[model samples]
Target: MLLLVVSDNCQNTLPVELLSEVEINVDCSNPDSDDLIGYIERTYVVQDAEGNISDPVTQTITLERVTIGAIARPADIIFPFDTISCSSGYATDEFGNPDVSVTGVPTTIQENYDQASAIFDYIDISVPGNLILIGDDESVDVDLGASFPLFDMTFNVISVNTNGFISTASGDAVPDSECPLSLDPNSLANTNGARIYALQDDLSADTTEDALAGVYYEYMTESPILTPSGMLTGVSIFQWKVDHLEASGDYDLDFQALLFDNGEITFQYNEIGTEMGSEATVGIQSFAMDDNTTPLHATTISCNTPNSVNSLSAVGLIPPTMGGIDLYPFPEGVSCNGYSQYNDQIVYTDSCMTKILRTFTIGEWRCNDINERYFNQMIDIMDVEGPTMDQLTDITVSTEPFSCEANVLLPAISPDDDCNKADIVIDIEYEVGSRIENAIGDVIVEMPLGIYTVTYIATDKCGNESRMSFTVTVIDAVAPTAICDADQISVGYDPSFFTAVALDNGSFDDCGPVTLAIARTDDPGYPDLAIFTDELEFGCMDIGNTYEVALLVTDTANNTSICTSNLMIEDGIAPFFADIPEDITIDCTEDIDTYPFDNPTVVDNCDLPDAFTVSLDTIDINLCGESMIERVFTINDSDVSDVQLIQINFVNQLAVTGTIDDSPVEGCDASDAPAQTTVSGLVELDGDLLISDACVELTVTSSDASTGTCP
Candidate 1:
């Protein structure tokens, strides 16, 4: 649901689902013709991301027409009466102090307006009092200056009505042309270019309510002549002839001074226009101001005619002027050949320098006669004080340094503006890296890491601009990093288990490491070592042994790291044999041949055995009944000899004997040897064998033929 409210507290509700926008067109049926003024209130229903509806939010909106106030009133001015003297120099009131005048004192009655809290826009000065008028049609050279001494001139401001009607405070609204002028019926154009002629008035003329008391209006239809000549002394005022004046409305005819030879001033209405309401406007028309160089000589500043006031609001005296007039058949497509006269009216020449005219219609130049009343205020002379000359002081701007953590522009330091003065504008300018920002009073800058500058500019309402600069620096937010490689190692060997030290190949980091320590990971007892200083020790390991060592390095940023390598230990080796045997020899008469070979020696890398062994290689026997032998020794348990060989020999020599009497002793011992002769004998080679097969050629001589036929 949506709710709407009017300025008068009126409420209106509108129901809707999910929608993007809503629009309504209304035609205001206002009773008053004045500008429309009002505001509207709106309430919106909003849904949150959670699908929950929120309370209605309200806001006020102002309504307005597409266009308004086409016409603008001139700003009021109140200073420097009608005249000034050269002996009194002008002072500047740059500060615009309301309590006092430029002389640093209280002001008089004339200056009292300002002290009493009065405000005015600006004042202007015109020279040679009778050449131009202050409040006339825009096309008129109202600001034109005639030759006159600066001291002899007076600066004054004209008061205009809310509708820009010129105040008729002076009686110069009309001129004494010696004849009355009226619209020419026969020469009427289509709402434009109505010709006027002098009429023979049949009665006395009232200066306040006579022929010039009415107003005039003119508007262009299509693309009318816009030549330079057409802009000056032409039918239209300025180049803005279209959609402004319709030739039928009330116009102001202010006073324009035209001095006669006798120094007496007369008035005229060469440029007059209908008063348009605030919404009326004239298109832009450009014109150049001619540089004037006229000489003036002051002589008591004498004047012939005294300034007077005359009101012409009583234009009802001329009833025919209220309605539009007709002016046709005047001329067509005139050339530009200097200025000339036609039918006693101003005319122009063609491009060929030939005089020509164009005929067109005209319309009414007066407002409807509704009995409108008006009053005028006039002041002819007065005295005034000078202006003040105080100036606004310059401002200083500075700021603090910036950082990426904050990521924004820092506030300015010692930033100040002169507050005593009104309408002082302060601005700040920033440059981040290479980009420059628009000038502002203050700002939060969003930028990357770079150097920058800020400038502060202060400008017073009088258009005095001053500037100062400040600097800002933004730092980066990224951190430094490191890269590393694995640790290295080396190997060494000894006869037995030996201590090993780990070697390092080094590591790499963008930032150097503060500490590098290496520890033996394989064995818990091995101590860690500081890298680049000490070597890693792995004591007493077996042959072909290897262990893991880790390298821990830390950088200045407190980032820890580790890498591993190997430590190899080698101790395995073959043992060598020592103390080998030698060959030995013995004669036949020797008693023994067997003897131990010298004990063998074995040397090994890991460990040596306590004993070795020896063995015989061969044994030899000789015919003389002797023997010899060869021996060998070994260190290891293999048949292959670790030590040298040894050889031993043994030999014995002896004679043979025989004995045979054993059996006879039993039978004939008693009988004597002679009687029985049964003697028996044994024959022996060495100590043991008396052979039974030996034929005893014992000729024992008869001996034991009978005893034993032993064969």
Candidate 2:
């Protein structure tokens, strides 16, 4: 194993076959102490089964670097992590007997340190340190260790960590006239028969020991002392002489003390009761009148007229103004006798002393009231102040859907008061029409929609009150309206084409910005007809039927309204007339002069001849083979118009042959035909049609027996 030894002169290294725990002694930094400051580094060399040395591992120990001088130094502090009774707790020689010290490595190390170990290298004991006594004297440095004999300082032992770091340095102090002295129960109950104890100047919590071994106490009471103006003042004076334990031994005398009210040092003297100021002070008298002890003697003692004292037990006095100081702080298991109210009070009367001076000169004796003197104690209550409320701002909110209740929000309000914020009481009130039925928090409240004035009042225990008001407004709500109408339209025995919107005058909203929608709610009047959105196509529909249409309208608030109208229908249709006989063929073999004619038929919805009028526009009967005729028809209904058509060929007659008597009639002549036929016996159609009035004639042929006109 590799072992490193460090010293102030130099460092040394060596490899050893076997090694146990290595111990290094480090010296403190104090100049007066005979110790060295150094460290030893240890490295473990691993060996295999064959006894061969392997890789070696090493650990480093760091030196403790402590700050010294005016900087706030980390001194030894004892928390008394557990409770210990005063009697046996202070019996231990040091602060913590058998205390637990640093033995293992800390989970984390300080940033300045390169490596860590359970043991420390160097410790700078000269870096000023303190010795603390739990609740006793203020922390005092270890440099004053030489003065421990003067103060009778004592301790069992000090616990140090494996790293040589100490968190607590506790010890007992020697009793003296100055510092580290206190009253046991600091406060005294104003009621009858209240008493307090005193603590030794030494920093020990041993209740069985009394530091005031040669001290004695006396009680006195008197009426108020008046000023030159006889102002009915509240001041009184107390005088006392010095006393001693032994003739030639040193003793602490001429000490100063302050009076208190409800654990607070009293501020005003003459202005006692309700007239006391924020702060006040009393003087401690040091004028010596006589010498009672040998080495040093306290002569005369005086103080400001008004002060607080032990108890109210004298005859004509104000209950003797209850308050007194004993020897030790009230113990945990001890009773306060008749002063149970001040049981847990801890009084450090040493804080009140301004100064303590001692002398070895002997003095002449004139008077001796060393046993007792007179001091005034007053019975006064502390003055209390009231609280104040801050200004409150206004609030506004909107109502929830379909509800009359308005949702209001109030900001946080904090009041300034002598009492705590939680102690201040808050009250809210709403005006007549706006009462809150329910409240979610300090801010959220449910109330009817209306103009309302809210009052917020805050109060404290002192009866001081403050108020503020705000207004809340709620709005009105309503809906929109829709109107639609179906136009009255007339058509023949057929569906009509029209727009529903055209017939509609649109819609109206109570509030503005409304939406309108149109839909055809009419029954299927005709399967061939389709009602497409705003437009409709007139197809096959029942002649005279009325249809109903519906329109839907909605407002921005989602309020809907529907309106409807009717569609009127009628059937006044015109007749349909078509000309069939465009051409008529006639043969002149059966000669005839005149032909009978029949008119084309007309069709109407009623199928009545009287319902329409028909006429042939034009007709021609001549010897020619072809003729033209024009026809016209009119409907009798006033709502419909007449329909008429024209055909070009009226009569198609041809004169092919003539009889012997009618062979070549001279009166009728064949003009266009190449071979001429004379006269016509009868005009008849060969295939298609022949009109009665359709007539044709034949001219004379080449040979004929009978002359003259063929008849």
Candidate 3:
């Protein structure tokens, strides 16, 4: 636990009693009130659970009293005055006091300039006496015959250089090769005089023909030129027809500088070849010089690089004019010009007042014949407070579905400043971990998933800054999409097992890695089996059967999705009969009531014998007392079948029997005596007979002869 104690006086030893708070109310009406001023001390100490006490730490606070007053106005003075006067010999304050003094603290003044375009008239100066032959890095003096005004100076003679510029004073021209051409006039090395660069570059007047390169100048006393400063009476025209030192054939330059009698100059381009004045300086420069010609300060006019001015066109400086300003203590009715004796007054111009804190003092003098008294009043203006920025809360967002980035719209911030809101500048930047990315606008575009610290800073014109920071958490919340294979997967029954990963076409998650899972959707009629696992097994029953399965995809964010696909178990092999019996033949008299051969073994690649069926078919044919029998055995599963054939032949055999009867032989002695005499024969077949025969014979003639002998 920590304890805070406050006291009005510092303690020689640690105070035993604890004072937690102190309050003091300031009286706004009274600047010297006792309650408005004081000092207090606060002491802090920490104690641990073991009753150990820490050393006391102390902080001191001071309070001060302040008063804000209005501006003092005295009678006999106009409402607003730029300068106070006491022409009546006696001036007094509002309280009638006559002793007074006035003082003013400095204030910062910001100056801004607005410019317009200048106009010019072109004149030709290519005559014979005007032509001067100049070479590389050389200059020639040309007598203008009259004073020409340029940069607050009048010159009767000017030096024209072959390097595309002219100097107002008598001196050798300096070739300025500085790219983008220095904007500071005094920074130009080696040349001190004011210069007009129509095209200042590394130039050459040397060519195949001398006439093609020359410096021409003519000062016309009666030349009239219309300009932004008005119509000028006299003018000096300097033209250069030269070539760049680095250019080849036909790459020439023709430009002119026009110096008006009013100190205004213009540069005109007659014919600017390709890259003629590309890297050249086309502007004016003037250095403020002391009496000894030592450079003191510089002024410059930049027409910018690459010569924005076109051919047949001219660029010049527009003379400045007095702009408007807001004045304090505006003028009132007071005619001081007619007064014989006036009081001295100090006037602070805009250039002299510059600061955020300033004091303005007004004084009045009171004079009665010879005795004088003075009184003064002072007013202060101060601004020490910074702009007020709105507090920002942390932002948490999710990325777009299936995307790694999100587009976040930040809240708009408009800071409130006590001085000027328009002068407040707001900046926004984001940092990831310890690295700063870049300044962003109101919207953070395509912000990837991460934790970022975004800080918004507001700075006022006085350099007072206020900043607020917040965390932006871009999260991944979108689930993965599970895409099952569109086609049904055919798994061979021989392998027995198939994995769930085989069913995934392309399961994806936007943020990171995803895990794939699969389960059987269709009923395989085996609920007790663990068929819903990642790997599924198929057997003889599952062969030629198709089942539905689903794929589940889950992302790191614990978001999941599911899709379904079909799985088919296939068996292409046919069942066969092992140890098939050979074809057999049997006689027709053999018993055919039962099968004579043992059943062949049925072998199936994926099915058991109980799961299949077998059949036996027999056929018999008889031809010409002979019969044949055939036994066909077949075994079949639902998908495939096999067959075996056995043959049995029944053959018919021929047998003959003969009988002779003697009953009819009683009538004929030898013929009937018997069947030997009355012999009768019959043919019978035990099986099948192709042919039969019967015969009988008698001896009646011998018996008739014996009966005739007895008579």
Please list the Cα RMSD from the true structure of every candidate, rounded to 1 decimal place.
Answer: 32.9, 30.2, 26.4
Each prediction's TM-score against the native?
0.22, 0.26, 0.33
By TM-score, who's the top model here?
3
Separate clash counts for every candidate: 47, 38, 23
Regions of candidate 3 where Cα sits further than 4 Å from its true position: 1-353, 356-388, 423-427, 430-444, 457-467, 484-498, 520-533, 536-550, 564-598, 603-633, 643-711
Better of 1 and 3 by TM-score: 3
Give candidate 1's TM-score: 0.22
Leading candidate by lDDT: 3
Model 2 misplaced stretches (Cα beyond 4 Å): 1-477, 489-503, 508-550, 555-558, 564-566, 570-614, 619-626, 633-711
For residues 563-594, write the lDDT of model 1, one tens digit per residue: 66665564334455665545455443333334
Ranking by TM-score: 3, 2, 1
User: Model 2 — which ten-residue stretch has the worst lDDT?
Assistant: 104-113
Residue 493 miss distance in model 2 (angstroms): 9.0
Report the C-alpha lDDT of model 3 over 191-290, residue by residue, as the tens digit: 6666667787788877564555777877777555665455656777788888888876653777887776665566778777876346677765554232
lDDT of each: 0.29, 0.33, 0.55
Candidate 2, 352-458: lDDT as tens digits = 11111111111111112111111111111111233355665655555565454666665456666433334556667776654433232467667665677886666
